[model samples]
Target chain A: MTKVTMTVNGKSVSAEVEGRTLLSAFLREGLALTGTHIGCDTTQCGACTVHVDGKAVKSCAVFALDVEGADVRTIEGMANADGSLSVIQQSFQDHHGLQCGFCTPGMVMASAALLADNPKPTEAEVRHHLEGNICRCTGYHNIVKAVLAASGQDVPAVAAE
Target chain B: MFNFDFVKPSSIADAVAAMAQTGAQALSGGQTLTPTMKQRLASPSVLVSLTGIAEMKGVCLGADGLSIGGATTHATVAAEAGAYYPALADLAANIGDPMVRNRGTIGGSVANNDPAACYPSAVLASGATVVTNKRKIAADDYFVGMFSTALDEGEFITGVTFPVPEKAAYVKFNQPASRFALTGVFVAKYASGVRVAVTGASNNGVFRWAEAEAALSANFSASAVEGLTVSAADLITDLHGTAAYRANLVKVLTKRAVAGAK
Candidate 1:
C-alpha cells in the first residue's frame, strides 16, 4: 500500500490505499466524497469527473497515488460555504440540464470546468468540451444550454497560481 | 477492484528496481491502467508509479529530434509539443476531452499499444525510437501485435524520440466510446522515404500498407491510392467494422492523412 496526502474539498485527507485504488475510490471511500460517480471503467462516460490541482480529470482513471500531494475537488465541494449551489450548479437547474440526475453532479463539475476555462464558448466548443462527460438523457440539448447559461455569468476561476 | 500494493519511487533507479518484482505493473498516466484494474482485466501485485520520479518528465527539442518524456501528459503535448510536431499535436489535441488529455500520457499510449491507438501510428510513421530500460527499439520493431510491445517482462519504455518528419499527419475514425481510433492512418515523409502506418485496421495489429506506400512513394497524391486495393485479409473484423471495410478505410484515410500532412 501507498500513503497519499491530498487536499480534497479544501480538506487535507490522507489514506493508505492499495495500488489499484482509483481517485474515485479514494474520494468515495477515504474522504467519503461520494459525488464522483463511476459510469464506465474504460475512461468512457465521464461520470467520475473531478478537479485535480484545479484541472478537470476523470477520477476513475486517476490513481490516488498519482495525486499524492495535489489538490482535488469533487462535485460535493462545488457549493459555497453556506450550502448554496455554485453558479454553474444553479444554471443546470434553471436550464433543466439533467434528467434522472445520474450524470448531473459530474455534468455540473465538467460544466464548471469548461466555463472556468472558456467563459464564452461557442456552441461547438461547448459540445467538444463536454464530450468526455456523457449524458444519456435529454440528448444533451439542455445540458449544452445550461453550460451556455453558466458561461454567460462569470464562474469562479480556480485559484490562480 | 482487487487490492494490490502500491509504491512511489523517488528516482528512476528505484522505479526500474520496482519493476524487477513479479506481477509488478508500471503506472504512467493511469489513462489506461486504472480502468483495466476496475474491470478486473488486470490485477498486478504491485504498481510502481512513475509520476513522482521527476526524471521522466519533460519535453525537449534536441539535436536527435523531438523527445517527449514518458510521463508528459497529452494536454501539455497538445499545447506545448504540438507546435513542433503539428500533426502529432493534432493527434494529441483530439485524443479525448481535455480531462483525458490532461492525464493521458504519450508513453502510456505507446507502451499500451492499443491496436487503434493514435500515437503509435504517428510514432511509427515518424520513425521514432522508443528508448526503454533494456535497449532502444525502432518503431518498426517495437509494436509486435495488438496491445503488445517489444518490451521484455520487466522492460518499460523510458522515452521516445520522434524524428521530426518533413511532413506527417494522423487521421482517425473514432470508436466514440473510448475515443480510440477505429481506423487511423499516420503518414510521414522522412529524409529516407515516406512511411505509412495504419492502426485500428489490421488484424495483426499496426501494419504498413506496402501497396499504398509503394503507390504513394511513386506519386504522393490522392489519385495514387485511388487505383490500389488493400487486401481485406490483413485487416481486422469486429463490431465497429469488417475486414473489408477497414481495408477500404485504410486507403481512404491514408489519402486524407497524406493530404492533411503538414
Candidate 2:
C-alpha cells in the first residue's frame, strides 16, 4: 500500500491505497466520495471527470498516487460551504441539463472548467469544448443552455438530442 | 486490471531507477496505460508511475525548438504551444474530451505508438526526438511496429524534443467511440525535406507516405499531393476501417492537411 496525500475539493486528504488504485477508485472507494462516476473503461467517457491541480481530467485515467501533492476537485465539492449550489450547478439545474444524470457530475465539472476559462463561449465553442463529455439522454440542448446560462448569457435552443 | 506493485516515484531519477528493475512499466499519462490495464490487455508486475516526477513536467519554448516534458499533458501542449506547433497543439487540445487531454501525456501517446493515434504522425512528420534514459532515437527510428518502439524494457522517455518547422498540419478522421484516428496525416516541411507521416494506415504502423512526401518536397504545395495515389498494400484493416479506405484516407487527409496548413 502507498500513502497517497492530496487536497480534495478544499480539504487535504491522505489515504493508504494500492498502487493500482485509480483516482476514481480512491475517491469512490477510499474516500467514499462517490460523486465521480466511471462510465467507460476506454477513456472515451467523461463520466469520471474531476480536476487535478485545477485542470479537469478523467479520474478513471489517473492513479491515486499520481496526485500525491496535487490539488483535486470533484463534483461533491462543487457546493459552497453553506451547501448551496455553485453558479454552474445552479445553471445546470435551472436549465434541465440532466435526464439520466449519470453524466451530470462529469458534465458539470467539465463545463465549470470551460466557463471558468472562457466565460462567454460561443455555441461552436461550447460544442467543441464539451466534446469530451457524452450523454445518452436528453440530447445536449439543455446542456448547452446550462453552459450559456452559467456564462451569464441567454439560453441556447435547437441543439437537438 | 491485473494486480501489480504500484510505485509513484517523486523524481525522474527515482522513476528511472525503479524501472531499471525487472518487470516494471513506467506510467506517464495513464490515459492509455490505465485503460489498457483495466481492459486486461496489459498486466505488468510493477507500475512505475511518473506522476510524482517534477522534472517530467512543463512546456518550455527554446531558441531552436520546443521541448515538452514527457509528463506534460496534451492539454498543456494544446493550450501553450499554439504559436509554435499549431498542428500538434490543436490536435492535442482536441484529441479527447477536456478530461483525457488533462491527463494524457505526449510521452505516453508517442511511446504507446497506437496505430490510430494522432501524435505519432505529428512526431514523425516534425522530426521529433524521443529523449529517453538510454538513447535519443529519431522519429523514423523510434517507431518499430504496431504498439512497438525501439525503447527497450526499463527505458523511459524523459521528454520529446521537437524542432519547429516552417509549416505543419495534422488532419485525422477519428473513430467516434474511441476517438482514435481512423487515418491521420501529419505533414511538415524542414530544411532537409518535406515529411508526410501517415498514422492509422499501415501494417508497419506509422510510416512515411513516400509518394506524397516526394510531391510535397518538390513544392510544399497542396497541389503537389493532389494527384498522388496511396497504395492499399500493407495498410491496416480493422473494425474501424478497411485497408482500402485507410489508403484513400491517407491521400485525402494529406491533401486536406496541406490545405489546412496553408
Candidate 3:
C-alpha cells in the first residue's frame, strides 16, 4: 500500500491506498466525493474529470499516488461559499444542460477549465473542448449553450450549427 | 489495476536508478500508462514517477532550438511553444481534449508511439532529437515501429529538442470516437530540404513520406504532389478505414498541410 496525501476540494486529506488506485477511485471511494462520476472506466469518457493543480484531467487516467502533494478540485467544490450553484452550475440549470444528468458533473468541470483557460471561446472551440466528455443523452446542444453562457457569451436561442 | 510499489524520484539520476530495478517502469503523465494498467495490459511491479523532477518540466527556446522537458504536459507545450513554433503548438493543442491534454506528456506520447498519436508526426517532421538520460537519438533513428522506440531498457527521455523549420503545419482527420488520428500529415519545409511525416495511416507507424517530401522540396506547393499516390500495402487497414482509404487520406491531408503551412 502507498500513503498518499493531497488537498481535495479545499480540504486536506490523506489515505493509504494501493499503488494502482486510480484518482477516480480515491476521490469516489476513499474520500466519498461521489460527485466526480465514473461513467466510462476507460479514459474515453470524461465523466471522472477533476482538477489537479488547477488543470482538469481524467481522474480514471491518473494514479492517486502520482498526485501526492497536489491540490485536487472536483465537482463538489464548484459551489459558492454560501452553498449555492456557481456560475457554471447555474448556467447549466438555466439552460437545461442535462437530461439524465449522469455526465453533468464531468461536463461542468471540463467547461469550467475551458473558460478558465480561454475566457471567450468561440462556438467551435466550445464544441471541441467537450470532445472527451461523452453525453449519451445527446443533450450536447444545451451543454454547449450552458458553457457559452457561463463564459458570459450571448447564447443564441436556436443552437448554432 | 494490480497493486504495486510507487516511487517518486526528484532527480533524473534517481529516476534512472529506480527504473534500473526489475519490473520497474517510468511514469510520466500516466495518461496512457494508467489506462493500460487499469485494463490489466501492463503490470509493472514498480512505478517510478518522473513528475517530481522539476528540471524535466518546462519549455525553453534557445539557439539550439525549442527544448521541451520530457515531463511537460501537452497543455503547457500548447501554451508556451506557440510563440516560437505555432505548428508544434497547434498540434499539441489538438492532441486529446482539455482533460487529456492536461495530463498527457509529449515524452509519454512519443515513447508510447501510438500509431494515432499526434506528437510523433510533429517530432518526425520537425526532425527533433529525443534526448534521453544516456544519449540523443535523431527522430529518424528514434522511432522503430508501432508502439516501439529505440529507447533502451532503464533509459528514460529527459527532453526533446526540435529545430526551427522554415515553414510547417500538421493536418489530421480524427477518428470521432477516440479522437485519435484516422490520417494525419505533418509537413515541414527547411532550408536544406522538406520533410513529410504521416501518422495513424501507416502499418509500420509514423513514417516520412519520401515521395511527397521530394515533390514538396522541389515545388513547396499542394499541386506539386497532386499526381502522387501512396501504396496501400503498408498502410493500416482497420475498422476506422481501409488501407486504400488511408492511402487516399495521406495524399489529401498532405496537400492540405502543404497548402496550410506558413
Question: Which candidate leads the pack in TM-score?
Answer: 3
Question: Model 3 over residues B159-195: C-alpha lDDT tens digits?
Answer: 9999989889999999989889999999999998999
Candidate 2 lDDT by residue in tens digits, B135-225: 8899989999999999987888888988988788898898877778888899888888889899888987899988888888888777888
Q: How accurate is candidate 3 locally (lDDT)?
A: 0.92
Pairs in clash, predicted candidate 3: none
Q: Across residues A30-141, which tens digit of lDDT does each residue of candidate 1 receive? A: 8777778878656878888999988899888888877889988899899989999888888888877788888887888888888887879977788898889888774587
Q: Give the TM-score of candidate 1.
A: 0.94
- For all predicted structures, in order, the TM-scores are 0.94, 0.95, 0.98
> Which residue pairs of candidate 1 clash?
none
In every candidate, how many clashes are there?
Answer: 0, 2, 0
Give the alpha carbon lDDT tens digit for every residue of B188-245 in model 1.
8776778899999986778887787777777877788898888997788988889999
Candidate 3: tens digits of C-alpha lDDT, residues A97-134:
99999999999999999898899998899999999999
- Could you report the Cα RMSD, in angstroms, for every candidate shown? 4.4, 1.7, 1.2
Question: What is the iRMS for every candidate structure?
Answer: 1.6, 1.4, 0.9
Model 3 residue B161 CA deviation (Å) reads 0.7
